[model samples]
Target chain A: MFRKYRKKSPWILHYNAGSCNGCDIEILAALAPKYDLERFGVINTGNPKQSDIFLVTGPVTFRSRERLVELYTQMPEPKVVIALGSCTCTGGVFRDMYNVEDGIDRYIPVDVYVPGCAASPELLIDGVVKALEILEEKTKAIEKPFRLFKEASSENGIINRRHSALKVGEKDEED
Target chain B: MSKKTIHIPLGSQHISLLEPVRFKFECENEKIVGVDSDVGFVHRGIERACTTKFKFDAIGYVVARVCGLCAITHSLSYTVAIEKLLGGEISKKAKYLRILLLELDRIHSHMLCLSHTCENAGFEAMFMRIMGDRELVMEIQELLTGNRIQFDYISIGGVNRDLDVQTAKKIIENLALVKAKVFSYIDEFTNNWSLSLKFKGIGALTLEDAYRFNAIGPLARACGLPIDVRNEIEYLPFDEVGFKMQTHNDGDINARNMVRLNEILNSLEMCENILRGLPEGEIFTKLKGKPKGEALMRFEAPRGELMYYVKGDGSAMLNRVRIKTPTFACIPAFSHIFMGEEYADAPAILASFDPCLSCTAK
Candidate 1:
């Protein structure tokens, strides 16, 4: 139902996972007039369940790891996660810092990685736009109907649960 | 009969909060009675990293990562402290370039705080307006330093880039635009009835409370306490570049917003003066020495006073790098201000304090 509109309107859920505020501000600037990510019908939502794109900044910290995962899980399926900035990608300058994990991908799957010390607003706008394409693919994958190509068995076309009876095109020796 | 107080918690993550900071407020009716904040969420163990992983020369950039908003200040203070230990004199042109970047940083940082404060108050248009105008400063920053957010502009003996004629023209043009927008904001903040009502008497901090709690930056300045690191530090020629202390006595959100607005104007004027008096000298000076002693450097970050303490043990690896960020210092005062105010106003009040948790956590 949302296929056509989904690509046009991708709601964003932004979370700061222990970043230096560089990427976070850039994300806001992207939403601002000059770069204007909002022109693509993108709305920054606080609710994870309603969001289709999760824009996460900073290298995941010990304390924020749980929040990062929780936010990711809370976001509905067929979602795109964009890691903004080098720190969020591979910990950047903060790679060796004790409390920081290498990047957010250590805790969750990231589809788009935009790297910079603090990624520029222009780059952030580009990242979000790229996320829209990923979001479209995930949405298509989720909504695509599954089809059965062939029969499973000769007798009843029913697959057996037991491992010994689970032969595809041949009966088990005991059978 | 005894009255029961209700507890309302706002973030380690919340809609109004941009970063992870959790505060539990115990409220008696609509008034907040107690506050407990947890600001360690953004801590990256940067101090430990400084002493062990990075060399003295490279720590300037590492420390800059502490907070993006005040990155320039962090690097400048760290570089200044290192220079003090090295005991070398950089060119006057280099100092001017450093000041130029510092003032530009302050302008953007204060504008961010003001815009954030507007956002938290549910003034969407005002927030967008301020944010849209902020790009003017950001454009200049990018032109001068080649990056918007993390401009690793300031280096040990000098700056990373020099200002060229084209960039200088861009800086002057954009700063004028920012200055114009700032005036309109000032008029809106001072005259708008709804904004005045929401901000005027809400979350008020008296001069006595400000002093007792040791508030710094715009927070203290708004309360009429003249505690500005810019005035105290002689390392940079702040006085030569027309640095003025902006203060307001009311100590409410409105007062703090006014202070920020006025400071932005002052910073714009300084940037103009710096560009106008473009001196001829080298931007970087090569100083040959290993840092051996301890040095404490303090500068006025946009949020407040940023202090960097560096103890180098003559080796490439230093002993300790402690950053006393303004947000960390103002936590006590932040909690104090939350008391006796409506729980609804918490976000606006919090934004007005301009807390930088990354800086604090680092």
Candidate 2:
């Protein structure tokens, strides 16, 4: 019951890793009335714990790398990550810059990549739409029950570290 | 009796800030006394990249990456400096087109700053209203320059594209709409009682403080100091294009808003005039030979004065390319204005200054 309502309202946390503010403004423009991404119930929240999706822009600078990881970890389980802009996707123009870390994917897993010099509002909206789907999938995966596996040597029924039955992308049929 | 001072740090990452700028404020009973700012978070070594990675001709587009809001100004200033070093003269039409885009850029940037100021002051409706109307200018920029944020329109010799009649009409239509919105905003910013409480006499910067700290752009203009780069630069023909300087006397948040609004009006007039009487000539001029000597170019970016100092060695690689961005220059003034203000008004004060950390750190 809570899952259906939660899917409708996914708050976003925007972090400027090391961008030129092109993507930052584009994100704002997407939220503004012209594009109206908020009509889909997306809120640009600042708190990490309350956010369900992360919209990160710019190349991951050396200084922001730690903060990026911290923010990602702070978000609750079953969250989606969207890398907006060319620079954020593959470090586009700022690639090979000494201080830049190529992209945010190096530090956090990205579910969607919105590619553009500044990622136009249309592209950003598309990426967010794609992210909503991924968020739903992750939520379902988290809710699925799993059976613990027994170790050959350990006495308890706790899942063995090496022989755990719950693989991330492995389908239920794999069992 | 002296009260105990408390230390408060705002951001390295905060919702109020669009960029990563940290300020450690020393406050005595809700009154801020001292401010220490760290603006290096967005530094990606663009200066190093300019000298080591990009070549002379390509550096124009590369420098445009310095700040997205003033990307055209960055490229135009660098391209002009390179042209000066190479002894190349661009056509008259190209000059007018460059000013058209530059003024449009100024209009968008000021709108963003004003809307951001409203957001910081807890005026969500005002913020959204300004942002929604700002799209009109952004649409004009897209129609004219082909891209919204990073329009690499100005090449070394001239511009990359020419203005068409349809785009000209679109720009005129949009500018009229934007002008009306800006007028309403001016009235709201002045007459709205709640806004006046938040803005008037808050984050006040006196003319003396503006001079002592050497504030630039709207900040200095608000203090009634007449120091606009457009007035000084002759190569760009800002005067011929109907460019006017907007200055106010109070030097508070309200005064800065007035300066920005007036400047937007002037820029709209300049844009309309450029389209109306645009010269029929070549959009670009082909220049020969490599840049050998040193050249400095200064232009009025939306924020303030943007200076580009380039030293060429008659080679593909440049010797030194120094960009003195306006926000970086006003770091002293920004800190000075924060002193003695109420701690609660810190965000609004910071926003009204229109601080660009990406430009500053770059």
Candidate 3:
């Protein structure tokens, strides 16, 4: 029940891993009146634990790597990560610099990548929409039952724990 | 009764902060007594890369990524420095166009800062209104430069794009609308009661402290120091466009807001002046030869004075690129202003300073 509602409204937490202010401002513009990203039921939150989407910008710098990882870990399960710039996706211009760690994917798993020197608001809105689909899929995967027994009394009226655990979900039938 | 002090920390990642900047504050009761700031989170070693990874001509684009808000000022300063070393003169039309884009950049940047300030002061509606109106300036910027943010219009010796009559008409129309909106903001900033509670007489830096701390840009100008790079730099024709310095004596958050608002009006006027009498000449002039010696260039970014020191060894790759950003220069004054203010007002006060952590760290 909560999973269905989770897709309706997903709060986002924005973290600048080491970006120029361009992408950051664009993110704000996405939320502003012109873009009105909030019309899609998205809100920018400060608390990581309450957030369902993580919008990470910039090429991850050495000093910000720890905080970036910590923020990713703090977010609840079924969360989606969107890398919001070319530098955040592949270290665009800051690649091979002394301080940057190439891209953010080196530190955290990314679900969607929005590529631009400074990602435009249109691209950001599109990225968030794609993330909502991913978030829904992850939610469904998490809620699925681990196994279903064929019969309650099998193998001399004893519960077959091994057999029941062996058939994981419904996909094992094809396998 | 004994007096005790408590320690409070804000940011690295606070909701109020747009960037990653950490500040540890020591408070006695409701009053903040001391502040310790960390601005190195956004540092990406661009200074080191400027000399090693990129050549002289490409460095202009590379430096623009240093701070998105002041990308034009950064590239313009670096290009002007290279022009000085190569000893070439750009056409007057190109100079006028450069000033046009620079002023447009300032208008949008200042609007962003003002809206952010309103958001921090707990006025979300005003934040939305200002941001909505700010799109007018952004539309004009995109019409002129082909991008909303990070316009790479500037190149060495000249600008990359030329102005057209259609775009010029649109820019004037937008500027007039932005000008009228700014006047309404001036009234609200001065007379609004809720804003006055958060901004007026709160987080003030006296004139003596501004001079002592070596504050620059609006922070210094708000306190009546009258320090502006546009007034001093000979590389651009600021005087011809009727550039006027805006200052206030109150030195508080309200004064800073007023100063930025007034500057936006002045910048709008300057843009109109440039478009009205734009000289007729080629936009781009191809210059030959590598930069042989060192040159220093300075420009008035929206925040403060941006200085670029470029040293070339007469090769394709230069020696060093040193960037002295405005926010980095005013850190001392920022810390000083927090003293004796209520801890609750910290975010609003900090917003008024318009600290660009990316610029400072880079």
Candidate 4:
């Protein structure tokens, strides 16, 4: 019954961590009339307390990082985070830009990943559906809240967040 | 004696969460008492680069890249400007092709702005539906120009490639599909009470304010001003083509979206008319010599009026090329629109202007 409820209503909060509006435009395109996502009960909410899924875009900027963390913390439990577009998932073409924070997962833990320059409508809708499943799982584990990346170390502290999948001292290509 | 003064270093570096606009948002208790904008980021010195780096005809392709979304418009305006300077006349058939491509571009760019605005407003379903429909426009562009985004189709004197009969038929068929979806969504979106409440009068800018700001595109048109460049400029046969100029008096975000949506419909019809009445002739005019004079050409890009000022020396290379994008003209308008609105509505309202950072910064 709870699983069905999660599927029936997955409230989302979209945050533009900072991007070229291309991906951001694609994200919005997924919501308009032709895609008709409202039939799935995937509504967008401005309030974090009401949101079950956080659809974060762009390659989180340095200045927006703290604000993002604050927003993430403000959300209620049983939440699933989705990093939308190539920028949030891997920084895409802007990986080398000085101001970009690399990727959103560098700051917040992400459960579902949608990849595209600005992801297509089909892909974005699919990602939202997948996030609802994750939301269902988080609801079951209410007592423990939710953990995204198991490898996320507490030692780094909030100011210096390590990429969840990144290993210590590894010279990996920055996503 | 009473004295008060505070200096907040806004940006030639930071402040705007979107494009590289540095502004000092001087506030007294969260009310913006004063604002100052410091532009010129990613200036790449494109104007200077155009004069020194590119040949007269080659610059058409370079200008297209100035704004990824408005690429076709920039290239179209540039080609026309150069043709005027060269004193060359494009074939009637080429004019029809130009009209077809421009309308297709307008549809794509407007849909993008609508969807992005909905996204910023936290409406995902609306965004998706608009975007899905947007692909049809992009597909049409790709069919015409071979590339989805920056279509290097427009050339000096005329188009580089002709719109094949088969492709024209496909474009017409695709537009039919878009029409169905667009109408359905418009009905759904306009009827949604929540969407209406969120957008209706939230970002209202008076006609006077818009005039003072010198807003362009849907923003200016939404305020009841008939400022379409197509209405003013002397293009080949746009006069014979029948279509209504889209406008609204609400002067708010919703009005802007409505204007864009209507423009898409009008654009589709314009494309169909051009295809049906396509004239048969050469795609480009043969030019053997160097350019000799300066030319100013303007066009109605999806965002608004786009002006191209090109100066050619007695050589193949251009001496100077200056572009005044619609968004550049709307900077003062954005400031005016931003006044007295909550911080939350700032970005969405700003986006409704269809501000392309690439075009403005260039």
Candidate 5:
């Protein structure tokens, strides 16, 4: 029931691991009246707990790695992570720098990768739109039954059932 | 009654902040007593990368990535330093075009700061309005340069793009619209009650404190400290293009806003002058020889004075590259201003200062 409403207003949490402020400003521009990302029901919230999408910019610096993971963990399940900018995806310019940790994907699993030195507002909006669809899919997947069928088991009951159910769900999803 | 102080941390990742910078504020009740800031969150070791990773010619674009807002200033300062090392003179038209982009960058950066300040003050409508109007400047910038944020406009010897009649006309039209919007903003900023409550005398730095702390840019100018790099530097012809110093005596958040607004007016005038009387010449000048010896260049970024020192040994690679960013210079002043202000006003105060951490850390 709440899953339908979840897709309508998916709040975003933006974290700059080590960006040059180019992509960050572009994110603001996307939120502003010009691009109007809010029309798609996106609100940039500071708290990770309240956010549905984690929009991260910049390659993860060594010092920021812990904070990035903490933020990712703090976010609720069925979250979509969008790596916004070339640096965050593959550490474009700042790659292989002494202080930088290359791309953020080394630490957090990224769902969508938006590439640009400072990804434009148009690209950011597209990324966010794609994130919404992913968020909805994840939401549906989470709400699905963990055990599809009740199989007769003697020893170690329900231990291997979770893995079997996950495999079945994966096969069904592929179909 | 016992007085107790609480340690409150602002960022690393706060919605108010554009970049990642953490500030640990020691507060007693509502008043802030001490402040410690960490700006290394965005540090990507660009200075070392400039010397080792990239060649001298490509460093202009590399340094531009230091801060998106002041990308042009970073490239311009570095390119000017290299040009100085090579001892080659660029055309008068290219110089004027450089100034045109620089002033345009300042206008948009200040507008972004102003809108951010409004947002911090809990005036969401004003933030949206200012942001909406700022697009006029951004539109012209995109029209002038290929990209919106990272305008790799300034290259070695000359700019990457040339100004045409259609683009110049469009820029003039946008400037006229933005100028009118800025005037209305000035009126609203001065007379608005809520803004005055948050801005007037809040987070103020006295003239003496400004000097003692060695504040630069609008923070210094707000305290009536007449230090502007554009007026001092001869690398670019800022003086010929209607440059004026804007200063205020209050040194408060409002004063800084006033100074930035007035500077926008002056910048608009300069852009108009440059477009009207642009000298006719080739935009690019092919200069020979690798950069040798050392050269130091300074330019007034939107935040403050941005200094770049380059040491080359007549090779493709540079021996050393040191960047002294303005926010790094004004750290003392920033901490000092936070000493006596209310803890609740910290975000607004920080916004008014417009501290660009990317520039600082890089």
Candidate 6:
């Protein structure tokens, strides 16, 4: 029952990794009164540590990939990642771009893939709700001292690990 | 608040704008002190790719995508440039049809600018009203060219489609109604005391400033400088299809809007005149010989003068192609105009130029 309450309210953090702003606007529109993703309890939170989900847009540019990994790792464990837009899922139209490395999944593991030059707001809200369902299943398994475990780990070490992981991730993908 | 300079970077990607361009804003206490802009983001090397990648006949289709709002204009200009280079002339009727389509595009571009500007201002109702009225122009464009926005009508030698009698009659009726409705909107916008306050003194660029910065289109026209390439370099049917040039002495956001609005009205008149005097002949003059050597061409787009320099190298494939869009000419003017304005007006001020970063970047 307690896990159900936690599952109902998942915090999301928004990231832009060098897009044309089409997806960014759609993201904003998804949060607006018209779409109202808030009804699904998918709230936008400022701090990454508190975030249960990460919503990333754009085709991870060469410079932004490092920052994106840092941000993704800062979120607590049992976190879900939603790669929003075709740019994030597979680099979309910006694929094979000179400066852009590839998609968001090149740096971080994505839980849900929302595709479109920009996925519509309604579709985005649906993807967020689906991510919350995944988080609930994990919450029930690790019930003991969950809040304590989250507080114990320092954000800095998580960031360093992410950087190293990204380096290894890139090499592995290239190989 | 202390007078401290804060450097805030905007764009490369922006919330309210489309097209990728970087803007570095130097702000002092929430007021913009200076704006530095860079528009070279999506440079596809289309001009370079065009000559080498695309054949001369097919280059018109590629150039049409250079700017979605002025697709037909770019295609027309490219075709005309090639036509002149080949010493080939289009039918008198084809020339008038080109003018009619071009005027419709002008209406499409101007109404879109006004509607989008209103949208940025949070006036959704006014935006929709302008957009709804703009459908008439789109309908005419579609009727003539079979596409709403990207009209793939202009071929190398002439137009691909002809204006039927019913379509031409509908265009005349639609244009008159659109003009009247646009004038009513203009009247409301001009008389709305608050809109005047928001626009009159904002984003001011003097005539000398515009000339020095090489501002083009309504940006220069707003400052009472009659520097239209159409007038400077004459085209067929321009003298016969009489239309008045609109100018304003004050180079503010309002002046720019007024110039665009007035220009749309004149374009409608030009369209009507072209239809009345459209002559009869074969549409295309056949290209028998290969285009050899290099040639440069320029045409006045709805935005301003567009230049295309082509080097053929005596082969079917072109050696080089360079294009200079109107927004490229106005980048310096934007940097100058953006200085010493409140940060809140940044989006509004930027949109006033009707800047197409897509064209600038390409």
Worst 10 residues of 2 chain A by lDDT: A146-155
Task: Write one digit per residue (lDDT tens) for candidate 4, span B22-119.
Answer: 56655444444565765554343457657766677677776775665777888888878777777777788888888888888888888877777886
Q: What does the lDDT come to for candidate 4?
A: 0.73
Docking class of 1: medium
Q: What would the per-residue lDDT of candidate 2 be over residues B196-299, giving only the tens digit for each residue?
A: 99999998889998889989999999999999999998898888878777889999999999999999999999988988999999998999888899998888
Per-residue lDDT, model 5, residue A156, is: 50
Query: What DockQ do the predictions score, one after another?
Result: 0.77, 0.74, 0.81, 0.09, 0.80, 0.07
- Which parts of model 2 are misplaced by more than 4 Å? A150-175
Off by over 4 Å in 5: A148-150, A153-175
lDDT per residue for candidate 3 within A1-175, as digits (tens), equals: 7786788889999999889989999988888999999999999999999999999989999999999999999999999999999999999999999999999988889999999877889999999999999999999888876545443436887776665544534454533
What candidate 3 gets wrong by more than 4 Å, as runs, is A148-171
lDDT of 3 by residue, B268-315 (tens): 999999999999999999989999988988899999999999998889
- Quote the TM-score that chain A achieves in each candidate: 0.85, 0.87, 0.86, 0.77, 0.87, 0.77
Candidate 4 C-alpha RMSD relative to the actual structure: 9.2
Candidate 6 Cα misplacement greater than 4 A, ranges: A1-175
Model 2 share of native interface contacts? 0.67
Q: Per-model C-alpha lDDT, please?
A: 0.88, 0.90, 0.92, 0.73, 0.92, 0.74
* iRMSD of prediction 3: 0.7
Question: For every model in order, what is the number of clashing pairs?
Answer: 1, 0, 0, 19, 0, 0
Clashes of 4: 19
* Candidate with more favorable, higher DockQ: 2 or 5: 5
Q: What interface root-mean-square deviation (Å) does model 1 yield?
A: 0.9
Clashing pairs in 6: none
